[model samples]
Target: MTEYARGLSHEPPLKPERPQFSSGPTVKFPGWSLDKLKTESLGRSHRSAVGKARLKYAIDLTKELLGIPDDYLVGIMPASDTGALEAAMWTMLDPARPATVAAWESFGNVWIQDAVKQLKLPNLQTLSADYGEIPDLSTIPQRNDVVFTWNGTTSGAMIPDTDWLEPGREGITINDATSAIFAMEMDWAKLDATTFSWQKVMGSEAQHGMLILSPKAVERIESYDPPWPLPKLFRMKKGDKLNRGIFEGATINTPSLLATEDYIAALEWAKSIGGRKALFERANTNADLVKNWIEAKPWLRNMVSDPAKRTNTGVCMVFQGDWYESLSDEDKAAVPKKIVKLLEERNVGYDFNGYRDAPPSLRIWCGGTVEAEDIERLLPWIEWAYETVKNG
Candidate 1:
């Protein structure tokens, strides 16, 4: 057993037989097995014919699942979602033009960091909200480029609706939809560029980023004169034309064929479950299962106080108490530590602790691969854990 698996303790009578509720890289794809890649030419050079074909398969499968537009370009970019976002920022955003970057959590903050600290872009506006709320898009200055994350994973918050996006306004809108891919509807017409990672909901391994560009994004890549130098990997549209070859499996660096096969499997699994509709239903069903239980019990409250913006994928919650509120960061960490340890000890759920930077709250991944039955199974254990730990 791997360290993660070994860490799990065996418990009888109430052994978890269904799916697990993990936030990320924790999906339970159907018939998932690492050994399936044994027939794959994963050992061959990425530049080899088989490797290229694998890369192409990954891209095509993603496009088909997502219903990407014909005119848009899809590429298997380097780095995870982080790298893909950075590449877009470095290559596409023009420092001279006014820019606005809105942040809600870590991922969005990273983009803001790159814009201000790293690239030192000028005429920039940083709009941010603390966890649950979102900045008013109407208040965002016009004639400025925009950057935002589709879902705030840490806060379990998301833009409640997409009607706020105004397409006619000038400047580009770059989105990091890493956890928002199939779980939410993406109006590609409103976004100039978007990025996502495979591990969050696709149940695939990490180390790959998928970048999709609108024609406007392509125009920006082709025409914009960035104030700084563009790295080789960040450069998307090469010399005023969309690099069509990249879409055809010409990755910037070597990609793992095994990972590609895993992604393909995830797509296949996604399709078998009835595409995006089923995907969203699964997420909603799982989240609703947890939310309904939380509502019935007075001991818990959702981290995102607002029900409208509460995310279905990363569902977070906090115990209601002055004791929890009165604790320092160290003491807060201790409570969650105790809670998670008990859960792990019972093999109920592993790694379901709150984010280190965020306030003490349980983070649950309720994506498509995580079943509603599992969420139902998890709630009793959470109650058991609270009782088991608090009594100590």
Candidate 2:
């Protein structure tokens, strides 16, 4: 037997009933069944009346579940959350206005790159923080268009509240909230545009994006023509006016009907569990179980130091044992891989490793779909994996 395997005197007594902890393409809602997707309009065109109605239902359900404002327009876009955010940036960010981009993690950094290198905006401000920290939201210019991620999926740091945003400001706030939606409560009144995907909290199939736009955002798109040419897919405007049809169920391209039905089923499950508040509660409860365990276990510490900034969905953690702390950077990186491999071999967890661009750590998805009881079962396995890896 291998040295690491031989070190274990006993196996963990229990395993998580569902072992999917991926930040994206997460576990499906509890009790989800393939039969729920049988009613999908698989052979019909997305522009057909039946297809359009199904798309509209998805948008309406999204707005209702998230408590989006009545004036906000929600649409299904191409690609995933990245496509939704790019569409917002390409369409709504007027060259006349200065741009401010804040980033503390990998996905947030992607937005910063789009503003600087791609758009090549001359008037730009970049606010950045380390992986486990959040940039000062108050420092973002109120008079400029702002782009940021609501939650740092890699870093596990999230904006605590929207109180920092200025009310009645001229700036448009565009947020990539792929990992935050459904799990956290957002102040939609403070945001002009928000983007998410079906794969994150809902555990639906990927390759689809949802863009939520406020009246101000739509007005910006309708009035300002961007200096750079917008690709056909990114174009939100038809002539001088906004493309109202896109917001009303006419997608830019064909969509996966199967994925659509899966999303609908997930939304229905959310409604059955008492909507957004209950979803938030479920995620929070899962996070609490981890937080409490971390408090009791000195070997582990939260990646994000500030408890308030810690996200309930993607829970990143770092090893803090003296031996672990003494290791070289290369060794430290290998350790997490070893631990994660051990867990996977036993089928206690999967995709719990931190993002490639972030610090070496563990990232556990504690979103609404994940049960607290499953997390409770997984914690002991994590402890066991760490011990075996560290000892070997």
In order, the Cα lDDT scores of the candidates are 0.78, 0.89
lDDT of 1 at 288: 89
Candidate 2 lDDT, 23-113, residue by residue in tens: 9899999999898775747798988888999999999999999999899999999999999999999888866779899999999999999
Local error of candidate 2 at residue 228 (angstroms): 0.7
Candidate number achieving the greatest TM-score relative to the actual structure: 2
Regions more than 4 Å wrong, model 1: 1-13, 18-20, 322-329
lDDT, candidate 1, 1-392, per-residue tens: 11222222422235455535556776657567776553456678877888788888778878888888888888888888887888888878887788989988777887888888998887889988876667776667657888999899888889887676776768888899988888988888888789988888776889898889888888888787677767788776666776777878988877777778888878888888799888999889988887887787676788777899888888888777665667677776687678778777766777778777777788888888886666666776677666555545
lDDT of 1 at 87: 83
Candidate 1 scores a C-alpha RMSD against the true structure in Å of: 4.4
Model 2 has an lDDT value of: 0.89
State the weakest 10-residue window (summed lDDT) of model 1.
Answer: 1-10
lDDT of 2 at 147: 94
